[model samples]
Target: MGASGPAVLIAGPTASGKTALAVGLAAALGGEVINADSMQVYRELSILTARPTAAEMGGVPHHLFGHVAAGELYTVARWLADAEAALADVRARGRRPILVGGTGLYFSALVRGFSTVPAVPDAVRARWRERGAEIGPAGLHAILAERDPAMAARLRPTDPQRLLRALEVLEATGRSLADWQQETTRPLLGAGAWSGIVLTPDRTALRARIARRFAAMAAAGGLEEAARLDALGLDPVLPSMRAIGVPEMIAAARGDRSADDAVAAAITATRQYAKRQETWFRNQFSDWFRVDPLAGEGAALATALGHFGAGAGGAAG
Candidate 1:
């Protein structure tokens, strides 16, 4: 551990047992868990986002999970600030902080820092949102490809929220989103202050877990949650609305698709999202310790404990 001590960062694809491992580590090290997942911040997205339940937390304190409303825009900057505060609070109490989730960008921003993009004018933002609503994500992505090819090449066409953001930034500042990202500020955690791990569970096993998890979600009131969110009549392009299972489950709730079909679609979408997450982790976290949770949770836990020089009955550092 450096002068700042060691905080554990656990990142992995969805359904990779990150939550369980985080809880286990927190319980062992007298630490608290801070959420890094983008969707899990929404209060209405518990089931679909696979947020840990109270029982799953095992009496270890968890922060920033389900703290924001679904209709609110929760940006990476906001999450970074919240996480920093949570980390400080944990350290102030002489407890380790364990940040865990599948959101690679969150981890990236925390470790590598992020530039604060100038806020777009309200009119400019509304205009881009209106265009997004009219053209849809694919059409918006096409427009981005024309205006900012470099940024477009980096973003997925199916992601409307990011597309709208990129278009708004370009129109508002006359610069590409990629250019803004390159002007990074100081990171929250300096080098050697934190130990990071990326879980790389076997794809076959992860896919099966995703399918089973979605099935469990559907049985555990996921449809009701989706219907409730849909009833709010929020913008479809909102981040919460774009969560993995929301669209399919909303369609099922509205009778546009059968429940079974919706579940299948949601499961497929989740698997695709997991693949993207895995790719991002592989590319961006190449230097971090890698653990395959599919092998055994004990081995993964042991590796993490080794990093902090902590035992099951001791605190990290």
Candidate 2:
């Protein structure tokens, strides 16, 4: 953004300690933190999403965190607009902006730009979820393959939500999802705009951490929270509504699974998400600096902090 702009960013899958790393880097670099996350924006879902706590924030200001109400679905375009404003403020105050989050799409939008992926109306989401129940996730995949075979070719066969969105976009706009995607041209960072890195912790360690975090969540009242949300009867397809553990916990609350079984399922789902995150950063951002969390992360991040003045390369997360 400026000659002296804060160039540091920390990103990784959930429970990889990206928040802790960001807070530490901000303290080290005289910077502030800006969220590049999706669910972390919603105030109501903070605890479930593992949002940075006041204690975790440690007096360093956090932007775009817990500012949105649960009901309002904020899109990536809105996130970019909001982040630009935050970056301006941070730079004005002579503070570096450290973007951190688990949402790869948000970070991708911050770097590679995104199109107006229409916010699927609640009715639209409901219809798809209902169809999914009747015909299964594979059914949604087939529907999308028929409408936008190109996009389908790139996605998992059972990614019901994405398949549904592609079909919805084609039906509603008379254009394929790939066409809108092709229109995406904004390099999110605006050409040499900011220095960034993805923290990819080891898979063995990441899976262990995910299991431990879910175990801790269970002990700390995840079940209770799930019970509370279950009473609301929100559609299962809403982004936050379908957070990693929600479905498992819901089934447990409904007596379809034991608490132990639910925890296992949630842990399994989180591990799956982490694997996707790993593959995403590895393939999509092969050029971006990476700091693996298991190794010399502190020094590696400090090196990344100098990216604005002097670019740094990979360091194990």
Candidate 3:
């Protein structure tokens, strides 16, 4: 944004040490850590989200971390708007802005821009979620299939989140989400504005990391955090509820599943989600350079920071 400043993005799968990499990079690059994580945005579930601790941040400024109440809904549009404001303010301060997280959708929204669809209300959402189960997601997929077969064709019947959202846009606004997306398309950061590094550890390593991290997290307050949020009883359809281990953990903590079963389910879910992220990155974030931390974590950080430095003087792409 200025003649000189850094706006860097560090992205990767869970347990890839993205938070440490981000903080270290931000500290080294004279940057503030701006959260790009979807779950970390919620105030009530820090441990479960693996949000950077205050001590971990090491006196560096962090923005949009635990700023929103969990009960409140968040959307890509709102996050984009918030990110826009944060970037402006960070640029004004003449400090680098380091964006980091594992939320692929958040990263995609930042790099490719997002549609500004209006808030889909709770009553409407409740009805849809209820209907989604009763009619089955396949039934909803059939409905979406009639409206926009192209989008529906790609979605699996079991992706209730996608199905519900597609239907919500159609029923609530009488316009398909795809149509709204087309009209609201905006370039992310104009053109060639920033640089990014995606931490791409080996597949086996990444899976082990996800599993081990979840296990450590479960020991280190993730279950408590999830239970606390679960007790709040917010809309079950909310995005946070579907966070990789939240549901399974919640059920496990409540004795619905054995601890072993819960762990396996969570790990399986996370790995599956990571696959989705990988596919998304391949398809959408084809421009980013990949960094394999397995080689050397420090080297990966250096490469990421170097990209930021290179792109700081250029306009956003």
Candidate 1 segments exceeding 4 Å error? 1-4, 310-317
What is candidate 3's lDDT per residue for 81-147, written digit by digit as tens? 8999999888888888888887777877776667777778878988888898688778998988998
lDDT of each: 0.89, 0.76, 0.79
Clashes of 3: 8
Order of candidates by TM-score, top first?
1, 3, 2
Candidate 2 clash pair list: 111-188, 291-317, 292-315, 292-316, 292-317, 293-317, 294-317
TM-score of each: 0.94, 0.87, 0.90
lDDT of 1 by residue, 1-317 (tens): 32234788899999999988899888887788999999999999999999999999989999999999999999999999999899888888888888999999898998889889999999998998998888899999999999999999989998898999999999999999999999997989877577788899999999999999999999999999999999999989899999998999999999999999999999999999999999999999888877788787488777767766642211112
Cand. 2 TM to true fold? 0.87
Candidate with the larger lDDT of 1 and 2: 1
Clashing pairs in 1: none
Most lDDT-accurate candidate? 1
lDDT of 1: 0.89
Candidate 2: RMSD over Cα atoms?
3.2
